[model samples]
Target: MQQGSQKIYFFLAMTAVLWGGNPVAVKGMLGEMSPTMIVLLRFLGISMILLFFMFYKYGKAALPPRKHVPTLILMGFTGVGLNNGLQFTGLQYSSAVNCSLVAALSPAVTAVLAVVFLHEKLKLRQWLGILISFLGVIYLIAHGSLEVIKNLSFNRGDILFLASQISWAIYSVLGRGVMEDLSPMATTAWAGVAGTFFMVIAVLYQGTGVTFQLSNFAWLSMAYMIIGSGILAFNWWNEGVSSVGPNRTAIFSNVIPVAGMILSVAFLQEHIGWREIVGGLWIITGVYLATRRSSMEPQTT
Candidate 1:
């Protein structure tokens, strides 16, 4: 690979790794904070961090123009506002493993949206891969309990998690146009600010109060989410999408569930059933097949 390609891959991998551990971090914060509080503080922290970068690098140009404000707010609502709100709320009911498995479907959804909205065509292998990955998601959700379909209690959290995934998919598809004219840092900063404002409103509506804990784990997790996943991962992901295109870059999201599951098992001592193993393998295989390039030649729009 060329140096630029290698750097893109490295950044993409870093983004996945940071995002992969997010479930565990969020899980840790659950005991210390309310879901809305977590979401609110997360964006608040990220917004501050990004603002510093904006001021340092671009000075006043970091503030988006009036014409772009509406688009940025929309991006904020879908990507940060709804996505984080739903995911964190879902985490309250579902296991981290469940949330991670469901989130693994993001790439497939993005691919479909790419085809529908962006008019991108996928190879046959890509379609097959998406199908396989989707099946894995279903398997994980059902836990191989086909006989108890109707008896299965649907958790509100699970539905919210699914909504979060869809919100993110829409954000990814729609943000493509906005990204054409904006720097990733500017986009992320502005969106985070908008999301933070919305989250504050939601928190106030819910009558949530902020409470701070000096516990090492909670502090560390919050710091990681703010710096690692919030800033670094988001920027790197936007950069990867810009460099390689979303269809290719979206595949890296497949790594998130795998990493989340592994961490959950190792650190949390969570049990990994046969269904989870099989489903995870299928998801990984599908992502690989979908992302693999057929020829060395780079695709051009």
Candidate 2:
């Protein structure tokens, strides 16, 4: 493999680690911070971090082009705003296990959405990979109990997590266009600034007070969400979509559930059944099939 390809895969894998831990962090913040506050603070903190770096590098041109301003704002709304908002809120009602399990849908969701909106095509293997991965998610979450999946007692939180995945899928597809000129960090920075603007407005409108007396763990959790997941993972994801295309890059998202499940088992003491092992294999196989070097070339516009 070429050096560039290695870097791209590395970024995607690290992004998975960050993204996977996001729900566990959110699970920690459930009682300490309101969902809106978490979203507001996360974006605000990341935007500030990104701005400092951009200003040092480009000075006044840290501001994006005027024509790109609106698109950036919309991207922020969907990507950071709606996506994080739904996720944090949903995490309040759902277990971290459920949230991560549901997030496993993101890759397939992104692929289908890309085909519909971005006019991207998938090789047959990639499509099959997506299907198999989805089935794995079902089996793992349902613990191999088909009746549970058949009856599918999805609560508000599960539905919201699904929405969050859709929001992110749209964000991922939209990112390909935006990255035409901007680097991954630059793109995440500007959209984050735009997204933070709207989040602040909503926070104020809702009269949510910022609580300062958080424990050390809560602070650390928020920091992870801001720096690790919000900033780094996003930049990595943008790079993946830009260089490898969404379908191949999104396959890495399968790692999120696996990571979240492990962490949840350790930290949250969530129980796991035999189905996790079986379902996880299906997901791994699907990712391997979907991301084979021969077919994983970047799609053209």
Candidate 3:
């Protein structure tokens, strides 16, 4: 690979690594903070810094046109607001391992959504990949037990994580439309502003009193989310999308579940068994097959 391509790959891999720890970090902070509060604070901090950077780089151009504002807001609502809100809340009822396992389905969901909304063509291999991934999700959700499925005993957090993944897929599709008229930085920064706005509303409507009596570890986790995953990962992911398109960038997410499981086990002392291993392998394999470009397909980068 060329030097420039190497740098993009490095950043993309690091972004995946950062996001791999995301669920574990959120799990750590849940004891000290409500999910909504954590979402509010994280995006609030990220928005401020990113918006300032956008303004610094582009001046008034950082802000989208008035007509484009609504799309950006919607993007924020789905991607940042609903995505993190649901995921963090779900983490309360689910293990970080489960959270990462569900999240591994993101690219598959995005691919299917692209077919419906963007009118993109799906190859036979991609369709098979999606099916295999869906099966993996079912296996994980059912805990590899027929009784869990028959009795309808499902982990609430996993269900919520699935919802969050759908929300993020919608956000990814919607962002393509907005990016036609704006730079990725502008889209990401303004989306952060809009997401932060929606999160503030969610916090107020939930009517829970915010508390700051958090331990040092909670503070550290919050900082990591705000800076590492929120800002850096988001930016780097967008940069990768801009550089090599979403398909290539998304394949990097295959690293997340692996990293998440390890971190969850190491830091949170969570257990992972055959179910997570098998399901996660299926998911990672499916995502790879679904997103990888064929030799006959034209390359953009």
| Winning model by lDDT | 3
The residue-by-residue lDDT of candidate 2 on 71-185, one tens digit each, is 8888899988898899889987777877777677676777789899988788998899878877776665566787877898646676787798889888878877877777778
Q: Rate the local accuracy (lDDT) of all candidates.
A: 0.81, 0.80, 0.89
lDDT of 3: 0.89
Order the numbered candidates by lDDT, best leading: 3, 1, 2
RMSD of each: 2.5, 3.4, 1.4
Clashes of 2: 0
Clashing pairs in 2: none
Model 2 per-residue lDDT at 18: 84
Q: Residue 199's C-alpha lDDT in candidate 3?
A: 88
Q: How far is candidate 2 from the true structure (C-alpha RMSD, Å)?
A: 3.4
Model 1 — which ten-residue stretch has the worst lDDT? Answer: 147-156
Cα lDDT, model 3, residue 97? 96
Identify the runs in model 2 with alpha carbons over 4 angstroms from their true place: 1-13, 137-152, 235-252, 275-288, 291-301
Candidate 3 lDDT by residue in tens digits, 13-111? 899889999999999988788999999999889889988887888788777988888899899999999999999999999999999989999999999
lDDT of 1 at 47: 85
TM-score of each: 0.89, 0.83, 0.96
